[model samples]
Target: MFAIFLFVPARADAAFCKTGETVTLEGEIIIPPVIDGGEWFWPGKFAKRPCQVTTLRGKGTLPKECAVGKRMSLTGRVLDAGIVTLEVASIRCY
Candidate 1:
């Protein structure tokens, strides 16, 4: 008799961002098609997951170069980790 076992690595369903925690993230800016809608961030090169940006406030203002489809780095406080909501403190376009 012979016994065989398979090994599998654990997978993360969603990126970890604790609520009320300050964090810096790098990603591309995304604008919704609808009017009056806020912006979103698509983190990582391959895993373009959408993270909602509820507000933009704090250190500096959003630059003109930080437009949709442009890659940028931002620091903010996580409002909701489930949907990845952030209240941006600063923004820098790369």
Candidate 2:
């Protein structure tokens, strides 16, 4: 007899953000489950998890077209890599 087990891949918790580094992350915006929680960005195609953005400041406003679950790009400086907080300089929605 043979036994086999298959497992689904776990969601990634670590983001590629580094403090003080400027990066452009493209992903879908997700609303956090908790009340009053800030919106999150899942920074990849088919990403299984989301990263939080503590604050968004600079050139652009949250466009009406960029709603939750919509794909968008955020260009920013990472303020906190642990929590994936970004000082967003620009935003683009598709």
Candidate 3:
């Protein structure tokens, strides 16, 4: 029963990307806080842009609560290929 329930897909499924569509996203990441000049930056630089996310690994989609300075990993399709940015995902003040 649990397995069957898990199989069910959620209404808000992550967005799927076309072959050439591209999107850029930037957010602070708590997984590994970014450092600049030996300082912990709440809002990291452009981290991922034009990122290619395979079925196994890719940011499908993120929550709205995620802020520019808050650590996060955005998952959007790229309108164009070979374009990436390293921006902040989220923030960890603690």
Candidate 4:
């Protein structure tokens, strides 16, 4: 007899990019369950994670039409899976 198995894993933190560094990522903006659970971010595909930059300085200027999984280019510092990208130099929808 043969058996099939399925595997699922818990969310993992993203690669940490130190402050003052630049990172360019393509993902969607999402609300987080971290840091009081009202955060924002540019999420990743596997974990649906963000880099933890939702409440940063340049956030207000970003056009939020990319919130619904449209690929957007976020260039800035890398934070974490629950949030990402800060000091955003540019945001463009693709």
What lDDT does the true structure give each of the candidates? 0.55, 0.55, 0.36, 0.48
Query: How many clashing pairs per prediction, in order?
Result: 0, 0, 34, 6
Weakest ten-residue segment in model 3 by summed lDDT: 85-94
lDDT: worst 10-residue window of model 2: 41-50
Stretches of model 4 off by over 4 angstroms after superposition: 1-11, 31-60, 77-85
Error of 1 at 16 (Å): 3.8
User: Candidate 4 deviates by what RMSD?
Assistant: 7.6
How does residue 84 of candidate 2 score in lDDT? Answer: 45
lDDT by residue (23-67, candidate 1, tens digit) is 776665675222233444333332223333444333333477877
Q: Distance from true position, residue 70, model 3, in Å?
A: 1.1
Candidate 1 positional error at 89, Å: 0.5
Query: Per-residue lDDT tens digits of candidate 2, residues 24-64?
Result: 76666675222233444333332212343545434423567
RMSD to native, candidate 3: 10.8
Per-residue error at 38 for model 1, in Å?
Answer: 11
Stretches of candidate 1 exceeding 4 Å from the true structure: 1-14, 30-61, 81-84
Full-model lDDT, candidate 2: 0.55
TM, every model: 0.51, 0.52, 0.24, 0.43
